[model samples]
Target chain A: MKLTIPGEELMGHGNLSCQGCGGSLAMRYALKALGRDTIAVIPACCWSIIDGPFPYSCLKIPVFHTAFETAASAASGVSAAMKIKGKKTTVLAWAGDGGTFDIGIQALSGAAERGDNIIYICYDNEAYMNTGIQRSSATPYGAWTTTTPAKKFKSAPKKNMVEIMVAHKIPYTATACIAYPEDFIKKIKKAKGFQGTKYIQVLAPCPTGWRYDPAKTIELSKMAVESGIYPLYEVENGIYKISRKAKNKTVKEYIKMQGRFSHLTGEVIDEMQKNVDKEWELLIRKEEFYGHTKE
Target chain B: MKKVVTGNYAASYGAKVSRAEVVAAYPITPQTQIVEKIASFVANNEMDAEYIKVESEHSAMAACVGASAAGCRAYTATSAQGLALMHEMLHWAANARLPVVMANVNRAMGPPWTVWTDQNDSLSQRDTGWLQFYCENSQEVFDTTIQAYKICEKIGLPGMLVLDAFILSHTSEPVEIYDQDRIDKFLPKYNPRYKLEPSETHAFGGLTTPEWYYELRYKIQSAMDEGLKEIESVGKDFGKMFGRKYGLIEKYRCDDIDTLLVMSGSTASTGKEVIDRLRDNGERIGLARMRVFRPFPKQEMRKLAEDVNKIIVIDRNISFGNEGIFFSELKSALYNENTDIPVYGFIAGLGGRDITMKDIEGMIKKADGKPKDIIWWGLK
Candidate 1:
């Protein structure tokens, strides 16, 4: 394999993240791309604990652990403060799915709408993994979290966060998977080049939350993209482009590999497959629509 | 430069002259004009600062925490419901020990929905480890704001300068806006020992176990204990630079008095006038206006209480299911004193009801050296 990723490690070892924690790798790759002159504003997420206790941190860059709902807002503050000081430091708001899709959505929306100069990355683990495996709005349909037991799985579909960011007409919005480090790093680097709000949601599979083998974290992340459940794509300046084409794997294969979806019946899996297909079709149509227009 | 401006504008000028590097605020009734004036100043290039129009007061304070932690002077302003919304971040800013100063127009909280003056909005945040300053008028609003930054930065805590809604916020008064060079000399740049710098990286507010969490809280209390002395010295420093003096509590004609009237914010102004008229009639009364409420001037209260036979605290804010909030805190402050002074509790002028000089006189007569649950004045 060609060594395309940066060799200089910004994230040190001995992090407190669980074994095979995809969120951990996501932070590592992001810091490598953003370099050392970056300030990360993290909310109440697994990364908050992953950075170790107070007076000690795992990353080389400064990390500001903030309240659960104010990651984007705090990042805006950091950006504003640095801007006034004439410091060219990259402000990154690194949050989990719960902080992004649920409690943090308002602050994220406000930051995006204002076109604040900050890079926001949401490491999507599908649930609130830090507190426990509780279901968040990012949890896909038929997913079983602690809050959504076997008898009552999550009925709602996962929120389409990229489209929401695209709606804000920000400079850039992308979806990358942890299995593809090159693509994730590329998106973060490209986001740093832009001078406004840039959002990227990276699919990070959690073995503890998903009830899968710890060693299968990378495998599950790859399967999620190949199965068309989480297509790697980016929206730049109102134009959508799929970064990686799906490998034509079935959604059932992706679901059966994870214990969180083991109890789902064939009928529910089929419905979820149909939902994924429809979303992919809509994304393709959006690309085609923009391609045909002057915008 | 003596500029006739509203209390809200005085706050804007205060932040401007203090050279705040970043300002984040959300508009609420009685506070909207403060940010508006700040926006005008920024737009007109009068002040060089980043004004973040955050979506809510929670984010306003959150941005202030971020900006302040990032080693910049951060400021913000809000009102009643907005201040209540910022309750969580208030604790965050204080715990992180960020010297972020804010202006809160004291508006009454609502169910019937009002935009009226009351101290309940700021008094509710008494336990949040923030230095609270209640301004008596527009000049005090301007003067205290500059002094708040100096005091808070010295103590490594956040400070809130409050002025009553409409009475101070909307009312225009002559405020002397000091020269920028002199104000800058009084309050130097905010140079924090620890900040969120990329060159010097460290995790702030991360998870701390019980072994360190208890001690971290004790440190905050210790800083507040130091804050009392800082507020006094900073007030004197500000007075020496400018002609206006300040302290935790302002004493008016309390040298020789049989009774002392205690109040805060605009009510203190009323109490001062009422005291002058009563003293003219040889009533032997004085007034103690609570300027800084957090490091509650207990020592000052005890020293003054020894000379007076009675203490009357008129609170515009209620603790609900108890007597006036100030009344309760005042009694607690006097509890350790060996004096048997009858501290009277007066709950009046709630929800923006006008408390006239006559009302103050009536409360003074009603004290009567008697124990009362709550003397509800102007309650029809």
Candidate 2:
């Protein structure tokens, strides 16, 4: 099959997204790779507002702005319908951390378990930006949102959604970041080739929610990967392959860039760093275990 | 082919003959056998459809929504918890106006988690805008499943074919499985007038501003209202071809009866038997079975309630704090009428308990002795 990366900007420029919003860029690049044969299912989040109002759509493809918890199931339906009509199109469910990890977990789990032929991408911005920056299950420890102020920061670690996806024994699962555009696009394109359920969790930095300089969006994403906070890896048929191995930058480099973690003291930063290191080590062991099993 | 078959198999056979292109399913008791049969049909190449084994009922409905939006006829089946899980997507399927057909094996919602027959599961979603049809027997289950697709596509609204859990879902009855050729002649390929195609760019699930939101809702309401007539016509056409006619409401021995027993789903069969037995013994008792519940069948219900001095509604589902869900709708439907009939609501067979002819006789006896406001029958 001839591969044609879309050159047309289906997601038009001059939208209302914040400067260098990683979520906005994720949609832009995803559309480029998937082409016009795509329907984006967006839930209640920044993208829902970013997609522009009715009669003036920002993207060229049809977008189904669904309820906060329905993106996964809605996308699953669209994908099944497409297969029935003999239309080879990708149904992409684009949701935020709050939508994916909290409200929409049941629907997401259902779609994954059924192996519905759909690509569900969660743009993890750490917190709910659309609903006034509330803490979500995906919010990392020590992060500050409207719900978790400096007086009471988030105590729990971010929910390991990748592990949950792995439990479903889906055909494809991967972690990517908007900072690595090539890797993110590659994972999405690779997911399209597989026939069953595929999932990708992309670390999208929110300048508004994270309280960061708008220009540091890409930089923060890169720091997240370098610090091993977000590893780029793919799980193909239960075989884990770490696509991008970090050079191991200090976690401080990633935390200092975001205001959500600005209130953390030296001890809290170190604790978060230790947690990140432990998680990264476990991910490495997983890659080794799954890789050896595949061989 | 005429054969003794479970209600689940009859519904599965109906979907197969209808040539449903997609079936997204999650297993819930009573409804599980229906999907299992459909899966076997797909596996055996008896049907050309994508069998999506979803993890939850919510996704099952979601997958159906996607398939329907892509311009393909989609099918799914669930009961109780599964139906509750798909509650959110049920509204979306209707609001999106996708002609997705689902079979809800009606089961009681639980604090007890019992897997038994009840109308609460489907009736709870009464306001979701999808058309609801209750089946009385295996034959109605088969015919209604086929007729649902036609009615749904005609009105561009999703339709649910509901049967009493355990009673119809597990019980075996004689059903004539219509041939594929006959089904093809009756239900042509489903061609959706509005679909999510890239060639024709249109907004779906877009932000409906104040200017058109109410109008869009009113249109859906009007579509549902129009569906009432469409369901009756389709039922007439189906009966003419298959030699079995079904109206929005099925009336029996109500011509001169002073008291009418109103019910829906499989228990209605038992009610009919009870009514026949009573009629033979010089009792002026009749039965009214509601086939269509969404458009409410207000006209037919009024006509049936007109001559009756007392109306007894047997509901298998409850609305918790309120009376029987169907009974509330019935009372509201007849509130303004000048009829002097005292309508009584009876909640029975909840949590899948068997509603035998004895239970019907007991309820009819109670209604005969000064009809109460709401009676909880068959309770321990």
Best by TM-score: 1
Residue A292 local lDDT, model 2: 89
Per-residue lDDT tens digits for candidate 1, residues A45-137, read 999999998778999999999999999999999999989999999999999999999999999999999988999999999999999999999
Q: Tell me the tens digit of each residue's lDDT in model 2 across A1-295.
A: 6544456787886566877788899888888778887888887889877887666678888887777787888788788778767889788899998999999998898788777788999999889887788999999989999999998999998999989998999999999998887788888999999988888999998899999899888888888988888888999999988988864788898888888888999998888888889988999999998888878
TM-score of 2: 0.92
Best by DockQ: 1
Q: Report how far off residue A77 is in candidate 1 (Å).
A: 0.3
Per-model CA lDDT versus the true structure = 0.92, 0.85
True contacts kept of each: 0.81, 0.58
In candidate 2, the residue pairs with backbone N, CA or C atoms under 3 Å apart (3 or more residues apart, or in different chains) clash, namely: A77-B63, A77-B66, A78-B66, A81-B67, B116-B352, B117-B352
| lDDT tens digits, residue span B51-85, model 2 | 88876787788778877877889999988888888
lDDT, candidate 1, B256-344, per-residue tens: 89888899998888888898898899889999988888978788878888888888999999998998988898888888874478888
Instruction: Indicate the residue-level lDDT of B63 in model 1.
Output: 92
Residue B192 local lDDT, model 2: 77
